[model samples]
Target: MKIIASTLLCLALAAPAHAAAIAQLKQFVSSTKTLSASFSQTVSSKGKQETASGVMELQRPGKLRWAYSKPFEQLIVGDGNTLWIYDKELAQITKRKQAGALGSSPAALLAGSNAIERDYLLREMGKQGDVEWLAASPKKADNTFESIKMGFSNNQLVEMELGDSFGNQTRIRFSDIKKNPALPAANFSFTPPKGVDLVSE
Candidate 1:
């Protein structure tokens, strides 16, 4: 499973231009409940790049499903209390308690359970092309990612860049975003295939 992080500026720490960007982000999060988007993810590490394309569905209060279709087939689903990761090539399924899994993790941030002000030090990085960028780093020293930046276009989330502590950079660009979509309950449900190994932690 690939997790991504986020950022948003605070008015106190930002100049007038940045403060306006922060306000737009705040409105985006507050007004959005369920979102579905097609994403293309690129991971660059040690001078090599790997790319994957996927569709992601997110519901508030900790529910998400990410399915990768290109390069490999994999599925990651979170159903409020548990996170399930299934690797089709490996024929394995791994489950982890969501509470422990999400602590200071990118999943928490994406699920809207982690407050940006409480967990990250946010700043506006100004505009790039048509997108406005905001960067954030975890306030705690033990975070998995070194920094995360989010890009927005017209107050809509369009891209995210994540730099992990392991020197790997992952960038995800969102397209065909549908905000507050009526996602079915079955979208977040996962059942392991027969004869597959299940590892729970």
Candidate 2:
């Protein structure tokens, strides 16, 4: 689960890119204020495969809610200043400062707090079928993923691939994406449920 969060944060940081691709990414980021999507995630590592399905919601200026519904129930929410991870079966909630949790991570891009041009080297991978692909590598040495590739269809993000140093790959496919949806304030706010042990780090 932690690895999953880290992978997402890594997506927020990207390096430089070609002129047209850069312009497209910039426009996509700027014009998008709120996004909601249903996603299917596949993680392949060491000849094994695991999959999960979830719904995600994101608001600009550092707010997101990720709820996992299949195989298990878990929630990860970031509300600008804090991040909360709640495990339903374990009945535990782990809380961390958002700054320490997201520092230099590409997740900041989703929050509208980080600029892609400043953090990642972006390259146009050209088109694959109906999707236009862009590859981004982090400028920092401490990044977790080896590289990140994003696929956009008609200016809508539909796929992402994250490769780690250990040859593990996580691919996420998005469907039913609603761009600039009117997400309520409560979606990003979380309070630990009763009987749950709250751990702060």
Instruction: Report the C-alpha displacement of residue 92, candidate 2, in angstroms.
Output: 1.7
Q: Give the best candidate by lDDT.
A: 2
Candidate 2: misplaced stretches above 4 Å?
Answer: 1-4, 9-21, 165-167
Those runs of model 1 whose alpha carbons end farther than 4 Å from true positions after fitting are 1-19
State the lDDT of candidate 1 residue by residue for 1-201, as single tens digits: 343222111111112343345566666556667778888888888898888887888887688888888888888888888888888888989898876666665556656553767887778888888878888777888877788888877566778888887888888888887878899999988888999999998
**On a 0 to 1 TM-score scale, where does candidate 1 land against the true structure?**
0.87
| lDDT string, candidate 2, 1-201, tens digits | 333455452122122332344555676677677878887778888888888878888888788888878778888899999999998878889999987786555566567554887878889898878867888887877776677888776556778888877788888888888878899999999988888999999
Clashing pairs in 1: none
Full-model lDDT for every candidate: 0.71, 0.74
Summing lDDT over every window of 10 consecutive residues in candidate 2, give the lowest-scoring window.
9-18
Clashes of 1: 0
